[model samples]
Target: MLKTRVIPCLLLRGESLIKTIKFDKYGYIGDPINTVRIFNELEVDELVFLDITATRENRPPNLDILREIADECFMPLAYGGGVKSVEDVRNILSIGLEKVVINSHAITNPNFITEIADTFGSQSIIASIDIKKNFWGKYEVLGVSGTKKTKLNYVEWAQELERLGAGELLITSMDREGTWKGYDVDLVRKITDSVSLPVIANGGAGNLQHIEEVVKQGNASAVALGSMVVYQGQDLGVLVNFPDRQKLSNIFG
Candidate 1:
């Protein structure tokens, strides 16, 4: 079996890094560059930097900030937020980002996925799907930073993204986001089973056991954590934070 990845998901609001609950009530954490320096020392497997407010604010990614974070990062970095065009993808990759994740843009024009993949290869493209369970208990796509709802079914979207040449899928459950209640296993399973491409499960990661559950049950290729790693007063992110290489190997290995 391929080793699973434990990735740190950082939410960037303007120039600073922050954490949020249910995609709202964001609390400023620290500087993005400083966070990158610390994660480098932690020797994490990979990093995901998202400009959480970009799409909601109707703006493009801050390339200048991205460049600074890229320079500080030692591990592979994936960036998303307000990435709307092939040029945006090209510019980000040019500055050394390994992958570009598209949420609102992809939902609006999936062809951009094909265009980006054709130019940069599938491995450079990631489709980030934000989902929320409605009254029907079915997961539907949420857009504009989880404020608006799209009629797209989560499973159908994931399959389409892969068919359009997205190399990976970053799935986040809005209902479970930052709750630390654990991932939405059923939601993860739906996307993972529907796509041949790698799927990274995000939201609701509370502990190592939750990490194991997401991979084993959700069938995710990777598990992404935010508050669990950023909350300074918590045990997971504070006292027992920054998993050692051996511990990571034991979990992913």
Candidate 2:
């Protein structure tokens, strides 16, 4: 089996990096470039930078910022938010990003996934599914920064994305986002069982054991976290109070 990956998920509201709770209550964290530089020094395996407000605000991705990030980041980088076309994917890839994550665009035009995969290969594409549990206790797709709801069920959409040629699925629980309580394990398992592609579980990761639970119990191929690393402000140059990379690798091993 491939070794599970531990990734830091960064949210960009604009030039500033922010964190959100339950997909709401956005808090300014720091500059993206500074954070990326710190993570690079920490020898993180990968980084995901998402512009949380782009899609909600109906604006295109900030390529200039992305270019700046790409120039600084040594690890593989994945970018998403307000990406809607094959041209968008091409432009992002051209800027040295390893993967392009499509969320709202995939729902609006399902065929876009195949087009991207055909042009850039499936490995360059990541289908980001933002999910929220409704009052009835079923997970549903939340678009436009978790404000708009789509009728498509979470599992069904995930399976369809893989069939449409997404290389990976980034499953984030809006309900658990930034709560630090734990991951939505049941939700993670449901999505993982429904698709063969690697699933990166995001949202509500508070500690190292939470990471273990998500991987071993939730059955996720990888885990992503935010806030836990940035909240303490130990030092902008070093890793804060998150799991040690060597220990996490051992746990996954």
Candidate 3:
């Protein structure tokens, strides 16, 4: 079996790095380049940075900032937000990123998924799907940084993204984000089981055991963290942190 990846999912609002809870209540964290350097030293398996406001603000990812991040990062990096056409993916890759994640665009213009995969190889395409459960407990796929709801169900969307040529899926729980209560294990399991592509579970990861549950019970191939690794205390003090390789080995191996 391939080793499971434990990735840090960083959120960018304009040029600043921030963290959110339940997909709202954004809080400033730290500089992106500085944080990337720390993660590089920690030797993280990979890194995912999403510009949470890019699409909503109608601007492309800040290439100048991303270029600076590319220079400091030694591990594989994936970026998303404000990506519209194949050209955006091409440019993001040229900046040394290994993959481009498509969320809102994937839902609005799915053919772009095939075009990007065909040009860049499916391995370079990551389909990002954000989901939230309603009061009635029905999971719904959300777009535009979890601001808009879509009719499609998470499982159906997962299968469609795979069929559309997405090599990987970044599945996030909008409700659980930054809460660190635990990952929505059953939600992860349901989506992972419905598709053949590698699924990266995100949101609500508070402890090492939570990581274990998402992989063992959720059957996720990888896990992504935000608040659990970025905050130091209840006050949400900004810190550059990550699980060391030994801790990761305990769960992944």
Candidate 4:
């Protein structure tokens, strides 16, 4: 991998792939297995699959579907959604996923992070933090797929997760998700500066410059691509693709 990781973060609705705008509206992308095959061919660094409906609908990790995905995925894979217990994390890793992203349960019971981290190891747990600007433009931490307000400051929460033994943080901007504007560098910077763990910046990214800005300015350790990798363009049709290898190497090298 390059010094900085550029990962495609795909969303899931049942077994089909979808892309969301601000965690509210969504558009169908394609089959999950088929999309993974394309990324494998592209030789991307990594892939992240988050089931958007899992937590909202009150379910567990769709192991059968995820099993298929893990079997087909050639690159290192991580998954989130409906992971509520240490067993959930255990089963997910048993099936071949590299890490588990915990959100709702992490808030309802902060000790869950420690439990999973202790049981499996901190490197197996990823704390998924969804952040959005309220009407007053104040950043609020969200849980349950960005539905419930946790009323916790993201930087403080990130530090807490780091203390609780989370290996990394997947910090996504709900306000910028699927907008193709760019990442919330200010918000991300605060979290990165506050925590020692690596952070994967998500939501908003139109092109290579956007990616460069987040890593260079925001101090992000990695980036997660949503629309930039799944769409042909802003309003264009769906296309399973990644950036050119040479361009990515040049940007980070």
Candidate 5:
């Protein structure tokens, strides 16, 4: 059986780390390097860093800060945001990230995905699909940090990503992100069932049970949590925590 990976999705704004809800209301979490050290100690399965403003600002990911995090990270790291060309993908991988994620460009310039995938092999590329429910009660694909909507269907997009040689699909539910309720299992299943590529479900992971739901029911290959892994207590103070060794073994063993 494939072991389900429990990943922490860290949001980046410039060099600082932040979290968001429903793709809005950004909240400062802490320093990226500091958080990475904590997760490294906890032995996290992997880490995903996304530059929330990269696309909007038309800037590439901060390689200087990312290099610092890469030096500290012991687990596999995947990065996303502002990757517009093959050179951008090459530079990110050269820094030691296991994968480079492409979002808005995947929709606006889909051929870019194929270009990168072909050059670096599919496993080095991840397709990030952000979804939000419109007023009409249907899930619509969003881009540019969830500010713009695309007419493409989420599942259809996932299929295209696989066809375009994306080794994995990272799906985030804008409505449930940072809500601490749970993942949108229906939304996860919508893509997992349509494609053979591994699907990493992000958003709405409140607890271990929520993680299990996505894997067992939604058939997701992995689960990525942001707020649940970063905050604690009644005040919801910034805290870097993860399931202990035995607890993690129980979940995936």
Candidate 6:
């Protein structure tokens, strides 16, 4: 097994899989089931399937589709996007997902985090904090898939979530997402410095060096890939792939 977790964070828009740029524009990738098969063959550490539109649409998770993916997926899977109540988390876990990531609902009802963490366990929960910088260059927390910006200081929020029983944090950078530039190391460092939860730095991973930088410089425990895994390269065609594990082990070790 790999010492450092390298997860593929796939975006779901309706029944299809897609990749987004800065959480705004998107390109069709392919069907989620097919994509999961590809990742399975690669023996990836884990996979994150986030329904980018589920929460914004005011609906519960699409259990039908999730069940399909769960049936086909061989590796540990995590899900985010329309998870709201403890019941939803229960249902999702029953489908074999290792963790349920919460965002908008956690802001609306922090108690929900406590309730689920108590009912399930902290290890089963991953509090997702979507962050973006404003025009004035201040980091801001986001809800509803990076559309609704909040005034909550991200570092404080991350610490609170860890205190509230979140075992890990999915720190997403809206500005660098899908740009293939790199992760927001500064943003990740602040949260890591403030909280002990394992930080999975998401968004804007162009190469393995970016992964090395985030884990070393940013103190991130894991790295999440978006554009780097789904496409052949920046602006290239869709090809579900993962970096060679030998190269990754060499870098992280």
lDDT of 6 by residue, 193-236 (tens): 99988999998899999999999999999999989999999988
Model 6 lowest lDDT segment of ten: 147-156
Comparison by TM-score, 3 against 6, better one: 6
TM, every model: 0.94, 0.94, 0.97, 0.99, 0.96, 0.99
- Candidate 1, 71-158: lDDT as tens digits: 9899999999999988999899999999998888888898999999999999998789999988998778998889889999888888
Superposed Cα deviation of residue 74, candidate 4 (Å): 0.9
Task: Give the alpha carbon lDDT tens digit for every residue of 1-253 in model 2.
Answer: 2278888899999888988888888777878888888887787888899998998888999999999999999999999999988888889999999999899889989999999999999999989999998899878898888888899988999999999999999999998888888899999999998899999999988878888899999899998888677786322332433457677877887
- Which ranking of candidates, highest TM-score first? 6, 4, 3, 5, 2, 1
Q: RMSD of candidate 5 to the true fold?
A: 1.6
Would you give me the overall lDDT of model 6?
A: 0.93
Write down the RMSD of all candidates, one decimal each: 2.1, 2.5, 1.5, 0.7, 1.6, 0.7
Query: Which residue pairs overlap in candidate 6's backbone?
Result: none
Model 5: ten consecutive residues of lowest lDDT: 243-252
Lowest summed lDDT across 10 adjacent residues in model 2 is found at 233-242
For candidate 3, lDDT tens digit of each residue in 54-141?
9998898889999999999999999999999888888899989999989999899989999998999999988999999999999999
Superposition-based RMSD of candidate 4 using all C-alpha atoms, in angstroms: 0.7
Q: Assess each prediction's global lDDT (C-alpha) against the native.
A: 0.86, 0.88, 0.90, 0.93, 0.88, 0.93
Candidate 1, which ten residues in sequence have the lowest lDDT sum? 232-241
True-vs-predicted CA distance for residue 192, candidate 5, Å: 0.6
- Which segments of candidate 5 are over 4 A away from where they belong? 233-235
Clashes of each: 0, 0, 0, 0, 0, 0
TM-score of 5: 0.96
